[model samples]
Target: MIGRYIWEISELRRSHHGLTLNELNERWERSSLYDGREIIRKTWYSHREQIASQLGIIIECDKRTNRYYIAYEDTIGRPDIQNWLLNSFAVGNMLMQGKDLKGRISYERIPSGYDYLTDIIEAMRENRIISISYQSYWKDEPSEFELMPYALKVFKQRWYLVGANVAFEGIRIYGLDRIKNIEITQQKFKMPKSFDVEELFEPYYGVSLVDGEVEKVRIKVYDNQAKYFRSLKLHESQEEIKTTPEYSIFEYHIKPTFEFEQELLSHGESVEVLEPAYLRERIKKRLEWSLEHYK
Candidate 1:
């Protein structure tokens, strides 16, 4: 299993060079391994040789240059290699576009209730409502919800159900795993007027609703954490302004939702609320209240 994972990492590194040895080792360590042993550096190097031999490509190394790259025109004209590279690149791009890049978690099993998912997707296309017995994590309650299914979204190895609630008469997002039972109803639903998925999720970081009202909120992040946010954009509405040598400011025009607040708080001391007195006070109060637990 370790050998296979090493081969996969080597393949990924070959496609995108400039991966350091430490980075490769850290990625392997983060993997879900049955045996609690570190993958030795020598093992990865040996597996690279095996992979090159199996693929009929010579592995070249430059110790002085400290570079690793695939540099051969042997099968450049082959359609099979071209198609393989295309599919690999497309998968990589999709993962990069997703929100859970840092977690880097992976699942290696076929989903069980795919038929049910397929039926719901088809019902959504047919403008139908679904009566679902959903188990919500927030309330831990298995309640029935008549959802006007709009679209299905997969994020971070999990599926999401996005639709309008028949009972609440508003939009809602549900996780597929939390659903206990689902049945398509005869009653149909018309989607909200001019509902665009891209426009809907533009202001928020996750799959959440964004009302028309926008708040100009300022957040201060440490230089190191700010660098991370610079490369990986959290929201499209985020704009950066340098504040000082130790910290920088990010401005966002977003609806202040519970999920958005959780995201900001996740950075902890690495980030702080700067503007919108109401938001700053909220964060400050939460910090003070949370301090009670530590004491």
Candidate 2:
């Protein structure tokens, strides 16, 4: 509690003498007993020496006005401590929302699982293949598979492990949530030196990768759906060619995968296939099949 008080006083000094004792007391009474009026003055006076000795933060109370302020600006400038103080509020908010955000209990959630992930990161760094009990949507069974975990990425709300299987197979993406267990093996493999994570996903939207030849695709958007496409970018490869009053035309130089088609279909009639006649026919067939469900 004393540590938190000193930290808060230091923060107040950074923000230019925030609140008077009465105002701070009002704010504290709403959140915790630490903010109570009876003990606050006594607590500050007694804790000041201890705070200065332990944390190097000197708390000062003005003689005439009796307002409190932190006097140690020099100590607050440390980079490591500054970074911790900056992110501490955000961490506290996520952990505890009911009480005062700062006074919440500190818990090391990720530190508990650090050993496994650290080993995995080290294996990736060392160009080693890991054997893990991998499970996914395609297979109902859990089996041992050797994977070269190249990039670990968190997208949406889940983590994805992207790499190739030891069978010299194509690049595969695995959801970390579904990974039952992992063990870093002694066997080392070469991560493709040619691969760049940013460039790998440039043409594709979301997690899906385009393995085949890239193709140029043109689509026309109509109605308010054009507004949706205007604000939201589908792919980095997309280029705006022309626009009519009622429609907007966009060309994406990317591989036409199942994922790309699904995205277009999601917007329905508001979006149309323009230049590629083959893609138009495919969309028509899918829409026809979709309409049959209602019939």
What range of 10 consecutive residues in model 1 has the weakest lDDT sum? Answer: 1-10
Q: Pick the candidate with the highest TM-score.
A: 2
Model 2, 246-286: lDDT tens per residue? 88899998777776889899998898997578888999899
The runs of at least 3 residues in candidate 1 whose Cα sits more than 4 Å from the true structure, single-residue gaps closed, are 1-116, 138-141, 154-158, 210-212
The lDDT values for all models are 0.69, 0.70
RMSD of each: 11.8, 9.8
**Taking the tens digit of each residue's C-alpha lDDT, what string does model 1 give over 9-82?**
44454456644555555655654432565546687577667755554344455677564444454554444454
Residue 257, candidate 1: how far off, in angstroms?
A: 1.6
**Model 2: runs farther than 4 Å from truth?**
1-119, 154-157
Error of 2 at 35 (Å): 9.3
Displacement of residue 114 (Cα, Å) in model 2 is 12
